[model samples]
Target: RKFWALARTGQGTTLRGNDQVNGYLLLATSCDGTLATTATPTTVRVVCNNTLTIALDGTTRAIKVPHNTRFDPQAVKKQLGIAVSQWDTFMHRMRTLSERKVQWHEAMGFFMSVVCDVPPNSKLPEVLPNERALRKVQSLYEGGGRGATLESAQGTAWGLLNAVTEYVDHERRARSTEYRMDSAWFGQGAFIKQRALQAALQLAA
Candidate 1:
């Protein structure tokens, strides 16, 4: 497949399905397996694709860098340190999710209630979209896939949230990988994750 070059840096290239750049895949050095955000010269991480979407990787994952920012690879890499305060909050949420266990059926139901099976929520605005969303979400919670493995998804809110994030970033149908990345970070998928996060927080409470 062909991709349009969206951004070029001393690190690597960010490619898009088109010039629109709602999102693009990033190819960069691993920075020893750490990932964080940057702001000087105006860098912003809109989406991180694939496993990188969830964490940082050495090679390609989707993202959006600000147009005005200078793509200095070293500068970008220098910014790769965990945000301590943010991670504390994130880990707390994850802990809550892990501790609050539910049965398989309940996990499935919670996921269904969160995924957008209807408009203004569904990533697919038309074309049997609601059904598509329902099926996609169902498969992630119960399908015999890595994200759906019972150990990962059947008993805890953390697992369920992980499954949803993994599915949205990698498995859900989209116009392109770039579109999927955009949705995962900025569009419907992002909203769904927020809902899932909120629901998870509630469960913890």
Candidate 2:
């Protein structure tokens, strides 16, 4: 099932250029028990069709019901209603991130920290960044990313966070579009994004 709804207030933010950003509430479920009934707050970049979940206080702010349990539409609605009320707070945080300028070195470090891997039995000094992914994300964060040049994004933590989201949603390798979408929303891609959000928030802080 697919549907779209606009926010009642604080509809969106217009960037310095033609790009605009809008918030959405995404609901999904599966009958075969492959997926959970979840309501996630999301944001879309109109220019490139990139998406990011609205995370607050390092949480995805998603409400989920396992398929094994009975579905409760009203209860889900109540939780969603509370989530919706956080739109203003979320946007305020985004604005703060946008204003928090980042140097190129800081941005590089941020990406390294996000995508690094430490082999089992390896020491902290052996932690290594995923070179290919690092290069791609760095390029995006440095201006190749969608909306990268927008005033709100250029050299800012908000922009850095969006860079990671854009990569996961549109550029990451996948066997098929469907697989990519599934991962972006509910699998490993989701975890990567959450990590990026937390890192970005730390950078801004």
Best by lDDT: 2
C-alpha TM-scores of all predictions: 0.52, 0.85
Write down the RMSD of all candidates, one decimal each.
Answer: 11.9, 3.8
The Cα local distance difference test for each model comes to 0.47, 0.78
- Our model 2 lands, by Cα RMSD against the true structure, at 3.8
Candidate 2, residue 127: Cα displacement in angstroms equals: 8.5
Model 1: how large is the Cα RMSD against the reference? 11.9
Candidate that scores best on TM-score: 2
Residue-wise C-alpha lDDT for candidate 1, range 1-205, written one tens digit per residue: 2123233232221222110112222332224323322221111122322221222111112333343556777644544322211333444445556667777656645665667433233354445535676666666556544534443235567556656666777788899988886676556876666676665566667
Give the least accurate 10-residue stretch of model 1, judged by summed lDDT. 12-21
Residue range 1-205, candidate 2, lDDT tens digits: 3222334334687654455778787777776777676778888778777777888887778888887889888998898888877877877777788889998777877777776643233455653557788789889988899789888888899888888898899989999977787788778888888888888888877
Task: Kindly give the number of clashing pairs for every candidate.
Answer: 2, 0
Clashing pairs in 1: 48-53, 49-62
Superposed model 1: Cα runs more than 4 Å off: 1-83, 117-129, 150-152
